[model samples]
Target: MSVLPDPGATRAVLIGTSHYDHLESLPAVSNNLTALAEALTGPTSWTLPQEHCTILSNPTTAEMTMAAVRAAAEQARDTVLIYFAGHGLVDPEGDLYLAMPQSKQRRVETGLPYRWIRQALLNGRADRCVVVLDCCYSGLALGTMGGPSDLADQAAVEGTFLLAAAAETRQALAPPDETCTAFTGELLDTLQTGIPNGPELIDFGALYRHLRIRLAAKGRPDPQARDRNTGARLALGRNLACLPTTATTPSADGEPATARSWPSPSGIRTVRGFFKSLADVRVTSGLTHQMVSQRSGGRISPGTVSRLLNRESLPKTWHTTAAFLSACGVPDQQVAEWYAVWTRLLTDTTTDAAPHTVPHPRQHQKPTTLQRLTGRLSRRNGRSRDHRSGSS
Candidate 1:
């Protein structure tokens, strides 16, 4: 029988390497491991026991790191999660490799091949195994090198779910002024805040859908997810609140870009009416759907704009509603009106009859890079696991 993960028995290893002699160093790496380890062991977060988690910073070799991972897999009674934030290189044969401090270009043997890690987790008895790749070439987690396909990796990688930071050929850019990679930044944010009006458990699919929307809205390369197990509903974290927290960005004249006040949609009676109101705003404001889509920086698509106008219901998140209204030239003072209408509809009786499931708008797949590999690569290493946890 497969062992189920008891909260206290879960094992995690968070790895981030910033020192690459041959590659430009990624400054956000160390910060990524620190923040993730904290959240995973947080009281109300994943809540994994402190000792069960490991942090490896600047691991010197492939064999040493994979050994630590395999040991964790053997010890984990239920769930296992391995999050790597650093450099990911693709060998000539198109296989993906994780970069370490001593890695050299074209020397595939010096880096940790992802398949080595994947095979270890697959052989383990953990009920759920999630690998989050927040590095360059992270897309290789899906086993696809060049692009994001409608179907995930051809190899049936059972028991492992992969979250890629970017499609092939796109870099998972670090936010210039922030301490975390752009992908990891949003991830930590979602883990901290949870979903808006979403369920208590933010499951895998739910988490990825939200990521898709947020990244697309920010005009960044979209992230991809591959879950081989259809029945897997792994919880990333619990909803910290029923409603998302509010923060305001003020304009030059001291005008709030996004109002923090919670809107009361009590007066709105139906989803149709709610969307119709937005449609009427477009007509009265004399703005076309294309204009609104462009204005949101392609966050909200023209197709979505049409759907919100023509369709009957709305998604639960505030991102879409806020983006839509902001694109509509809706004044700050009055933006709350549409927001209230959408918010109210969530609790109103009309939602029951309206088919309320939110649709995930698909992102366009990015181009793939095909670099040639000539010789076989080897793996070398030192001793045991190392790196201090941020927590006491």
Candidate 2:
């Protein structure tokens, strides 16, 4: 099962280049950046803070690198998402570079090499990184040094997902009459409207599938994707298309009408309160422990689920908690919130177990005979030696 990124710890950097010195201008690139930023930060999506989302329009190579470095440095625990919508240039050696405003055709030095971005993500502290490239030959980023189609030897950072707009040998489309680039326009539409009857959260895997089908149907370039360590399952936005039209009816997740009244895990600090919230969610889900275990993809056992609800202590691992919550039909956003609370509670528990400041008391003991004799001898010798020494 996939866990949603904590919006508070996630960062998004959107880069676009619309005008070029020696290449055709893409007037739609600007719109792509703006619309994407709103979609990522809006309430229906990850709810990422506006300040956490950086948009660079027609930036110099230096400016783009610095922004990526800053984001990588700041995001330590959650995810880092980098998006670029512009011209993709290939070097003589077939390596990919993202074109900048000052970039000239076939000039490698004028553009930003994809290796720089790759290195930044590798050096960063984020647990996962997502890269979306919407430009010509963007798919080259997924190609290994050995072969364009051989993904087995791809040297991507673990927990990284790469989505390219076109194949390594193809050019992404930018229809002159479209508001946004062909690839990004479809992406924006998906984020704003979402998949009909799809999962509640729009994960990378689902998004890629949607894009592949939609773009293919339009006779556009097929999108390419490479994922490591289940990064494609990471969800960054909500599926607005799945919103229920009426609250009185059972929703897609099979929750009862009164499921809306279930207890919330927000603002819960104590272990007991957390468990109580879990129990309430389970109760509202109307599923037996066995059913929950099955829904969890067998990550948690039925006995473990029962133990979790009956015990007042927090679960030893977040994997179990997440699976349990997901099985109970909790949304990914709420699951992320629960993760934050679980983290704090676990930290407090560990801190409380540390050694205290006050020393432990010890039993009183009498001095030994040898120590008393030595003390008396030292006192007599001090008086006699002082008097003799002064006379001398």
Candidate 3:
């Protein structure tokens, strides 16, 4: 028996976090959070009311996440959906848990327990609760806690379904490119345009199959579904006959008929805001200084890092600027978009291929110590080659 309720009457609380104080994290989590929120709230004309959806993001901390989960569960009437995208680890006791900013990988015992989440669902007022865990080692928490058979039995009585990104021993892949996590990206892609409505309801079995196929297409490890209750299933309920199958098409005028576009100023602000957000994350993660030195191969100085962060100096070459952004995990598309917008503002045309050229006040000045050392090494290598050639 599964613990999912009538899907049509469900209220969702989607949360995504990516930045871990320690661990290899991706900016994709933040992007996925934004995308998921849009999918739920956007005027895609899903059969459900938009007012029932709630979304949250906490890339740096888990304190807010706990509060959001509790509040959503309390407020939910029929069904509660919780989606998490971040890091997961196990404690010495073999208990699985999600990692927080202050989480100590070594002392995993202190991390937030996965059982806490289970207990939340068990105690929550909602009739059906769905948990989507999109993180590496996610299955460890659910798999070690109990077998799918036990969960199915519980769900038959209480209604609960857990979807894990991978098996206990496998690792889930991050976004292949600039998209969200491979699993989440596919989920959204399917939800928006794939599923159709009517007599043929998108069953849990079908949905999982769709998600699995999409993830596998991206070369990701397949996700496993655990159904604990046999009689439990997701239904649209009375208020909603079926999840809206019609895709929202654009108007003839090239404007979204239902979806609202950000105002020009707001769009510009969002672009700039994203950059500032990345900068802030870099500082908090201590990756800014580390990235500059790492990409420069010890050529960049701490003082140069200070200047770049303070905006007192910019990278003199496109390669350096791109590398710096890459180190901070800013997607190339986003950088290109920003650059395109800037070019349009200056030239009144959106299409431009001219490369960005940095203007230095003292272009003829001698190269810095780092450049001089590299130049000398190059000359020495050339002379050695010449001598070798003459001897030969």
Candidate 4:
């Protein structure tokens, strides 16, 4: 039988969360989301458009996530990609559901249903939809959902693919030094640097094997990992890079996609400037400062706060950026504005604004007792530990 091919246009939604108010899981989920967002949308060797993807971190509920998924599916043209990194729990029936930010550990039944995600894929119009889940015990729940025969049947009827971190009984880890869960991090590393060509041209089976070998090396072999890993393997009947029959020639409405490249120095300065403004607002508006600091998990020191406002330093790493943004409760739209401004500063040469001079760190304010306590707790938890399958 002739196999159907993936459609040309692609849209994606990425959701990540770690700190659940009552879920008892630490704040590792958001880290994976931020990392995946940066890898997928950042100006890397392989580029996916910033506009085409939406990211939600520390969502209030599974319903909220499902809403986002529905919206993305509605917007997609040919393909839809959904990635989630968070806690996974099973019910008495052994069905799996991803835990949301407001999830209660004791009230596991309230979590979002995995079937909802599956249904979303089955209903979407896209020729193909891929879902990547990263969480402990994620595989267990995912394993019962369906198999290759079902997937083949589904693909024949409505195209969809599912990738899970590990088997139902196995746990997926988030290593301390790493930004993403082991499965996601390795998968992205392979996708970004390992793929000879981008997704369109890459061999799905080879990619699956590569991911399996990488995960096995980590020593936490997921039981369902092998089955799902191989069963999900796909080979596009035709070259994905080639345009579809329905694809039109370049026109005003259908211009050839091009990446807006930026110079290193300009991009850095713009990012610094934007964060500096945010810091200034935080310092000037006590309410903003309190809100931002509280949201960030109380990790911001008075000195660090001062430095950030003064534009003396911003978080050097993406993790820090994620934390700061999380703490500040910066909305995605605002972040999108910052991204636009930064991109403009990098690409627009007509505006030759000089870099602002950074002020010295404020001297009077001391680290609050709450800050100290949270810092101690965070450290005691070994904040730098990466969450991997094998790592406790």
Best-matching candidate per TM-score:
2
**Candidate 4, position 187, lDDT:** 67
Candidate 4 stretches greater than 4 Å from native: 1-8, 42-46, 106-109, 138-158, 195-200, 223-392
Local accuracy of candidate 1 as per-residue lDDT tens digits, 1-392: 11113444468998888777777677777888889988887643555657878999999988788887998888875578888877777677767678898776556897888888889998886767888887664322221222323213522257767777765454446765777878888988998877887654566777788888998898777877888674236666555654322223436654346433221233234454355345544543345777778777889998888876666446767787788877765666577766666667676645575697777866865433432121111111111112223333
lDDT by residue (305-338, candidate 4, tens digit) is 5556554323434444444544443445555555
Cα lDDT tens digits for candidate 3, 1-392: 11223223456766665555555555677787777766654432222345566666653445566677777678665667777776666567655666665566645643566676677777778766777776654322221211222222222224666666654344555634647776677777765655544222333555677667777777666766665553125421111233222323436653225441111111332222223333432432234475546644665655655555544222334454444544444445655764554444445322232555556688688889999999999999999999999999
* Candidate with the greatest lDDT versus the true structure: 2
lDDT, each prediction: 0.66, 0.73, 0.52, 0.52
How accurate locally is residue 5 in candidate 3, as Cα lDDT from 0 to 100? 33
Give the Cα-based TM-score of candidate 1 against the true structure. 0.57
What's the lDDT of the predicted structure labeled candidate 1? 0.66
The total number of steric clashes, by the backbone 3 Å criterion, in model 3 comes to 13
Q: After the best TM-score superposition of candidate 1, give how far the Cα of residue 277 lies from its true spot, in angstroms.
A: 43
As a whole number from 0 to 100, the lDDT of residue 91 in candidate 4 is 55
